[model samples]
Target: EPEVTQTPSHQVTQMGQEVILRCVPISNHLYFYWYRQILGQKVEFLVSFYNNEISEKSEIFDDQFSVERPDGSNFTLKIRSTKLEDSAMYFCASSGAGNYGYTFGSGTRLTVV
Candidate 1:
């Protein structure tokens, strides 16, 4: 079965640096989303993009963050300026149908020093 795949399972970065997390969402899906989970915190939705446009975004998606579908299978999240608070597990998810369960990638653990 097709599954979402993420690279660099764990990343360590310094504050005020830049990082790009990569993901390959399940093929044939239309909607893609990014979520972050802080240690001992609930998963928070960051953004959802579809048809090359942002469908919905949370307040957490600020100016420092951006996302792109650089190719047919790759979706990436870029943080232009990282902060200590950015340390978390970033999850990439996709769903064929809205209101259904999402298929999440194992996640990229980003740790900012």
Candidate 2:
């Protein structure tokens, strides 16, 4: 089966540097989303994009964050400036809009120092 794949399963970055977390969603899916889990916290939705524009975004998605489909197969999340609070497991998900559960990437563990 086709699954979402994320790179650099683990990432370590400086507090003020930029980081781009990458993902490749399932081929036939249309809705794309990014969620983050801060250590033991519940998963929080960051943004959802469709039709080449943002459909919905949570407050967590601030000026420092942006997302793009750089190619036919790759979706990327860029953080302009990393903060200590930014350390978390960022998961990429996609769904085909049915009763099926969203498929999540293994997740990229971001650590800011």
Candidate 3:
């Protein structure tokens, strides 16, 4: 079965530093998404990309954050300035059309000190 893969499994950075989390979703999937879960908090959606554009985004996806598919197979989330409050597990997911068959990556754990 195909799977979404994330890099660096874990990361630690100083507050205000920039960081980019990477993911490779299932090749055939058409919808891509970014989500995050702060320690002890619920998983929250940040943005969803489809047809090479942002289809939807949550309030959390502020100007400080951005997502890109630099390559057709790779999706990335960049934080311009990491904050202590940004420490969390960032997840990348993809799904087929009609919003079915969604799969989530293992996630990149971001720790801002």
Candidate 4:
């Protein structure tokens, strides 16, 4: 079965540093999303991308965050600067038809010190 893949399953970074989280979504999927779970909080949507463009983004996805599909198969999320509050499990998800049938990566746990 096809599945989303994330790299560096765990990352520890200092505050003010930059980090790029990588993902390879299912090849057949058309929509991609970046979501984060801050510790005990519910999953929060950060951004959605399709056709190599950002379709929607949440308030939490400010200038510090960026998403890109650098190649046909690779999707990435970059944080301009790390913050303690930024620590969380970042999930990469993709859907074949818009908002349905999503397949999520195991997730990359980022710990910002």
What TM-score, over all chains together, does every model reach? Answer: 0.96, 0.96, 0.96, 0.97
- lDDT of candidate 4 over 22-66, digit per residue (tens): 999999899999999998899999999999999999999999999
Kindly indicate the candidate among 3 and 4 with the higher lDDT: 4
lDDT of 2 by residue, 43-89 (tens): 99999988667899999999999999978888999999999999999
Model 4 TM-score, 2 decimals: 0.97
Q: What digit string (tens of lDDT, one per residue) describes model 1 on residues 34-107?
A: 99999999999999999987899999999999999988999999999999999999999999876877899999
Query: Which regions of candidate 2 fall more than 4 Å away from where they truly are?
Result: none
Give the winner by lDDT.
4
Clashes of each: 0, 0, 0, 0
lDDT of 3: 0.93
Model 4, 107: alpha-carbon shift in Å?
0.3
Q: What is the lDDT of candidate 2?
A: 0.94
Give the C-alpha miss distance for residue 96 in model 4, angstroms. Answer: 0.7
